[model samples]
Target: MTTSIVIRDEQSADAAQIAAVTLAAFATLEISGHTEHYIVDALRAAGVLTVSLVAEIDGRIVGHIAFSPVRMSDGSAGWYGLGPVSVAPDLQRQGIGTALISEGLARLRAIGASGCCLVGHPAYYGRFGFSNPPELALAGVPPEVFFALSFTGQTPRGEVVFHDAFKATGPTPA
Candidate 1:
């Protein structure tokens, strides 16, 4: 059976459901620090979530993806970082995450973004035209897992600094 999946921009009301999906998606992944939801929240709070999208099936958010601007050591502009993409644990192998990523990248390019990068599994991101460029690095992250896709045909050289929100380990203090 083919399920109809709708990919759309996130609305204010989807915040809770998005967080739930993000938490459930990374809960069992050993590589996850279990702070993905917090990172999303922080990104939203900081108003730097350049592109935030949600995947809906039968009116429920089942997956989410976020893209945020990144600062490059070489002063490159229009570069964004893709990360913390999430899909419901039960729906992992489905195409939901892929759909979200495709749409998000399209939106980024439509807005004139020069490039996008992420720290993700090479196996998965490679299919999306992402590659580990020796010219780009993300500090302590291994080169094998850091991927980049240049929309403008020119990859930036130097370090890629993701938003500070990536450091969120918990909810914002009240």
Candidate 2:
């Protein structure tokens, strides 16, 4: 039997579960700095978490994804950054993360976003239409690991600066 998964906008009550899922997802990822949960919290606290969604199965939160505005050095507008998507470790490879990414990308397009970029596994994100564009770069990040998908079909040319929250290294202060 196939499991049913529901993807929906995150509610305030889902905060703790989102953090737990985020932490668990990246806990064993060698490339992960393990500060994803902190980044999520900072984005929310800074009111820059433009799109935050949680995946639910059996009424329990099992995955989370976040999208926030990104600034292009060229001054192009309506671009966003996708990140920190997480699925419970026990549920990995069960399509939970795929469902979350698909739904999240649809939501970004619905919002009139010009494009979305992310630093992710090259093999995984390509299936979602994310590609490494030589015209755009995120400083300090190699081109191969950085990917972008242009909803408007016009790729911005310049450095992409994700929100400062991406630098979050600790929990948010009350």
What TM-score against the true fold does each predicted structure earn? 0.98, 0.98
lDDT of 2 by residue, 45-146 (tens): 999988899999999999999999999999999999999899999888999889889999999889899989999988899999999999999999999999
lDDT of 1 by residue, 8-45 (tens): 99999999999999999999999999999999999999
Backbone collision count in every prediction? 0, 0
How many backbone collisions does model 1 have?
A: 0
Cα deviation at 141, candidate 1, in Å, is: 0.1
Candidate 1, residue 43: how far the Cα is off, in Å: 0.2
lDDT for residue 42 in candidate 2, whole number 0-100: 97
lDDT of 2 at 141: 96
